[model samples]
Target: MMKSFFKVIFLLALTTSTKAQELRFGLQPIQYVSETQGPYVDFFSTLDASTIAFEMDADSIWHARFKVALSFEGKVDVVRFEYTSEDSASSAPLMLQKSTFTFDDTKEIEKRPLEIFLYDEVSNSDWSFSDTLEYVASDFWLSQPVLLDDVEEVPVNYVKRGVSVVPVASLGLPVFENESTLSMYTEGFVASGKYILQYKLTDAYGNIIPGTSGFARCNTGSTPVYNKIDFSSQKSGQYEYSIVMLDSTGQAVAERISPFYWYNDKADEAAWNGPEVSVTRAVFENGWGQWSQVNEYLRMIAPVATMSERRIMTNLKDSEDTARIASFIVNFWTDKNAMDPLGEWKGYLVVVDKVDQEFGSRTVPGYRSQMGRVFLQYGAPSLVEERSFDGRNYPYQVWQYDQLKSSSTPVQQNQVFIFVDQELIGRQYTLIHSSALGEVKDHKWQYHLTRHTNAGPDIDATSTQYSRDNFGERISNSIIIGNQGTWFDRF
Candidate 1:
């Protein structure tokens, strides 16, 4: 009886293993949703087609059922196939027959979703399976190729180290899906060398995201080799792209790594529509006299100056009496505090110096930057929240002041400034909307910041129903101005 039981157990195990092998089907490489730009004429043409493999056990049923389905823009189409006589051997693997299905266009430019469903009704217990992809319409917008080193405020150039290309500074630019045509111009410094350029998307923690990597090969010719990347399939976010050039023996000779911001339609539109910013060229280009330059520097400080101080600086700019201007500069601080006038002046100088070093960009002075201007004016914020990068929203930083100098006299509480990296690039964050008076105010700031969340109304709406935790709020005309006492307390 024991021997019979053991044999029966072995047979049962064998039967289970055989049943598992009776039917199995896997999809080949399907066209990824992120890679597509416009509507596909033939969806299969974009896919890397491969045969679906099927294996059957010897005792498995010869008759089986198969099904395929496609869905797009809320529409669905399904096809069913039944196998009667066995066209494939039971003991070997067989390639299933392929099917072509047509998808009708909705005449709209939006996310077109596709889904495929397959069922094995006989050997595999008639189990159901599904896969999906999202495509866009012809109205998909593409990004114009932007040289990373040539951004408005942050321009960078590649430095040649031996045979490798290195960015002079860390560079960033907004890349869109429509700009599928990626071309890299490499000066043919190395003849007959093969270069492989690739990009990979990584989260803030630096772990690579799956299915977001691709590579292309370019052979160096007599002239500069313009290598066009096969495709761009990256989704919206920050990513690190690297290129490596190999010698004839396949040894890496040169390489470079650059950071990039990938943005979608709404984010791109917001970036393009940022406030027009112009920094005075006189700061960097003009060769003014020593006192004239000092007067110009004082004018830049007007953003943070008291009303009286601002008037003095403005008058000094037009003053021809150099001695009077010089005396006013000294008395400007001495009158405020007779005890430590020099100390106050020196302290303010230190702040200016720090702001220049920290906030100064290629095109704008430190005090001219959005953050720099606010820092100089309001001192440091009481509550600072920074969301540098997120999968959903554009990079933004929130500055909250429990008490602030809203104007020359009135003090206000619960004041805020929402600086958005509307350009999606790292530099050039602008004051999109603010709560402080005498400052640029836009009620739709919350909508642009949380566009990815879809929690608010359209961009044109003055107010959103949903408020984000850090940066969304409406300012009222009435403000609590109980204290000029605590105003300078934190300052």
Candidate 2:
């Protein structure tokens, strides 16, 4: 009798192991209702598998959980459970389930229906299986199954992401979606007087989910701020307005088109044409001398400027002063020449004439611009070529000075100036390049020059002299001058 009992127990264990199977599925928890309404509930009741059993800790309370089980080929698995009342009322449902199973290939069982049974319990209500359900199954080995639960509260948190502004000119007068902001700046509504509108949306846990849909609504008189959409003077047409999604940090994630209102049935059109010219003139005159000259220029030309213009101008100096100094130096050189160094000041005048011819405009004269003045002083280069070797669309100019009669290699310097109404007022200058010529003998400078502007080359370099091919391009057959002993040796 004892031996028989032991054998029966061993066989029962083996049979149980052989009959078990596993199923794999995914679960995504969702919020079905508001926290104040009650705990959200979702049911997964129509499963057809045999030998059903759930994989879960019988004791611990699961914030989110999924159900999984193993069953025999012709049997069904039943998983029945309920959330704790205290936690269910406020918390989200379980997300997935976990379980393990193994099968043996030594024997095969006939295919059969695998059924899953589910039920629920409520106050004063008898526990009963739901009948309005559907089932789907497949032939093959089962893995793990997942069951999802509904979430209660949708928590949200938002932050100010970034701020940007587009110039009114670039957007045109009929701005459609010109001003925008993320949830960080759109949360508040206006109650009276003046207020700010700021809002944000977050998940149940207060984490921001970018690109989610949500809306904010409140009466203007009840909030501290309001969106006084000033379409008062906008054209007579339909407009749109909408609340766009932001990133996890409460920044606007993408551009969106929203809804807007219309102002039809013409009322005095000229009334909304904005302030009169005389009013603007009066304001400008009153604020004119309050700022530094440079600051005033910046305010006048800059796309946007409210204050601080005077402060900036006071700290800046005029650039024409340097240009004047350069002009004086040229005059000094001309006066010192025993004979005409290059010809009468005619050569210099020719350079000035070229500058005027090429760069002179209604607003800016050729000599006033840097490139214009440089051309006037330097004369037409010996060779001029344009190339677009770089991966840029703009063509760069190359200026070659065959033998730039200078005592030393050229030292490059640059200056920038701000002008107002054709008058130079602010200047910034800096030295950018200087070729080193140490105590090494037979030092001579050779240069190939380029520039960033339209008037000059984009790249410049210098190396040993070489021969020219039939096309006059430098060939690789010439000797290096720096390696030679003296000027005579170089020749």
Candidate 3:
């Protein structure tokens, strides 16, 4: 039995000013392996080799006698040609018929005169045609997210037209250039099982936009399944797409999600640039406080700035004068840090970068995140308590500040901020409650932490007071809810 396992062929279409042609011969990655098995004792001599073949088809006829044997040492020796033209109307003798072109090495043949020329001696005697060819190796490789060993798989029901689907393998669809399509390869499954392909798109804020979920049944008869996800009709914006897998019995087995960003280059260019800024000589020389631009630094610091300072920034925007913005930054920092103005501003930039790395979101940078705002306003939290998502509730976090400080001015102490990932995906946590005044607050903070529980307020009381029994600590059950009651609320 002749068995072949690995091969990938990509059909590329090229269009010129006058005509369109299809390219079918150049294989992607341009590598093929052919093998032949031998008896158990003949392992050393069992044939395992590779070769390249090309065929020319025109006028509804096919011909294929060209073979280029690839050496085991990764080089080409010669190209054997054995093609004959069947056009009887042309009495032209094939010029390079039955020819063998020897090469010193692969590099020499790829760069030299390998173009074949034939003459139609009967029809056109001296009307000569020329052909030239040159070859160069490609350095392209496919891109995908790095899968770590400890990465957890999230299984999602494949949704299509509000219906559920099951599949064997899933690929998280990614944003593609408008002219391109998303391509992926999947393998490792018990043969003869059925599968399906599903995709869902969500906007920057995690809202499932209407008319986005779609699916298609996949033909899994071949090994190493190849797929293409098209996006010719999707709009330009940031989105999240997921792929879910189901078995032959229509049960979800695995899933993966990835981000997609499509830039809208055709939008109003001027509107995108926004307002420009102007700074003083001292400030400009200090690298405009190390932000990408002076205006960006102004925008980032807005959350932590005082009302009066925010007014100045608002005025600077209306003026559209870079000089005024520059002056405001210098005077603002100088007034805040008269002795070491430059050093103080540079130090703040460090905090901004750290916040961005830790709390940034798809639509908002870290410096603009809810946690980021508090960090810049009150400094680092004195204590941070994190609880991973346990499928009972959303991933929730707690931040406690020993003292609330603004620009080094002490405000309040023993303050706390609570954030919850209500969606359980996307990782963008919302501040649901806090102990600080003027912030969103609710006395029942623990209730929100276990929002998915049926035990309600009493379960919140036991969990908050740490008085729940050993069994209660392990799982959330209806029996625990009835027994625990609200006894701990007295404390």
- TM per model? 0.34, 0.18, 0.35
Residue pairs in steric clash, candidate 1? Answer: 142-178, 149-156, 164-254
Give the candidate number with the greatest lDDT. 1
If ranked by lDDT, best first, what sequence of candidates would result? Answer: 1, 3, 2
Q: Per-residue lDDT of 1-491 in model 1, one digit per residue for the tens?
A: 00000000000000113233322333321111112222121221111011222344475645444555545445555545454334553443222222333333444433334455444434343333333333333211111111222223321322212222211221012233434433433332222335544444443235565655555454432223233443344333444444454544776654544345443444333432344222233422332225545555555555555533443455567777665555554555555557876577677778977887877778877776778877887778888777866666779887889987522323556887778887787767777656664455543565576665654444433323444354433444221111112112222
Query: Considering TM-score, where higher is better, how would the candidates rank from best to worst?
Result: 3, 1, 2
Instruction: Give per-residue CA lDDT, model 3, range 1-491, as digits (tens).
Output: 21112222221111112112111111111111111221000000000010112234666442334332322222223333343445321232111111122222234343233222222222121111122223323211111111111113422422212222112111111223343344333322222346654555555445565655655554432223334445444344445555555556777654545454443332212222334334565658556554336677676666555433543555454456666666667666676688886777788888888888888877888876677877777788888877777756567778887877553122566877778888776557877666553355444455567656536445435354554321222222221101111101111
Screening candidate 3 with a backbone cut-off below 3 angstroms (N, C-alpha, C), the clashing residue pairs are: 167-246, 277-322, 278-322, 278-323, 278-326, 279-326
Give lDDT per model, in order.
Answer: 0.44, 0.26, 0.42
Off by over 4 Å in 2: 1-334, 338-347, 368-370, 388-392, 406-491
Tens-digit lDDT track of model 2 for 392-412: 112224345443322111222
Better of 2 and 3 by TM-score: 3
Better of 1 and 3 by TM-score: 3
Candidate achieving higher lDDT, 2 or 3: 3
